[model samples]
Target: MAQLMTIARPYAEAVFALSQEANSLAAWSEELANLATISQDPAMAAMIKNPAYSADQIVSVFTEVMGENLTKEGKGLLSAMAGNKRLSALSDVSEVFETLKAEAEKRVRATVISARKTTVEQKKKLSAALNAKFDAEVEITYEEDASLVGGIKIKVGDWAIDGSAQSQLNKLGAAIAQ
Candidate 1:
């Protein structure tokens, strides 16, 4: 997984630079998402790996499947990936592109896992707090996990704040056992 991400990073960065210059970040985002979806399909995966299909043929099939949704730049990306036999990296490329897009837009995605569903007021407050903490706009997604027992666990990017009753108990247990 890490190696694939490393391999995909350059492609994602190149696309990001191009999109920035073209002022088509959103369009490129959608295009990368669609390409990743198509490339990750099990049938498409098999076809991509098969030696029977030439690179041009695979690109044609991909472009045909995309229909009018594909742009000229999208076709170029597909052709390059096909030529390089890097179609399998599409998922990672999409992920990296989204990360870059989020950073560029000054937005962060946060997940709040709680024992129960959060109220609208709670969500709003949490969102505000996260925005202040990150100095960026926060997009919150709430999830329920009864195993948390109480409180909430907030995850944003590489950081996590674990404030659940289960976590406290585990910490207490470890301290006592030591």
Candidate 2:
């Protein structure tokens, strides 16, 4: 909820600041992702909610479970969040941080689906073309769907370029009917 964002904003900001200072933005991203993933486990959720557990105990458990993924700063962050009873918001902070990171890097994550896998050369050319078109780095993820029949459909942000065989067939069918 929007109200949760309000509560989580300060925690996100604090983590962002720490990440910047340590020159560990990428590292923090990995650690936060790990934390968020683990927190999603029902068992972990219950442990975090159990009132009998001390904040330090929860922080220790998170650290031990997090393994080497938690750097010193990340561990400190976990402790702080546990102490403040804000661990539930770690996922929100991680999601917001990823958005901020993407914006800062001027990168867009794109999904490209085609009838089959694209060749390395085709991927290179497409990425180069997209980078030139967007004036930013493009991370292209591909999916294969025989249902596409042929051609490729690209979803970039709000825009989609539908160049699939199915679409062409529909257009041809409409023209024949008219």
Query: Pick by TM-score: which candidate is best?
Result: 1
Off by over 4 Å in 2: 1-14, 49-57, 64-89, 157-159, 167-178
Global lDDT scores for all candidate models: 0.93, 0.84
> Which tens-of-lDDT digit does each residue in 78-161 have in candidate 1?
888889988889999999999999999999999999999999899889988999999999898899999999999999999999
Candidate 2, 82-105: lDDT as tens digits: 898878777887877786677667
For candidate 1, which ten residues in a row score worst on lDDT? 73-82
Give all TM-scores, in the order shown: 0.93, 0.66
Residue 12 lDDT in model 1?
96
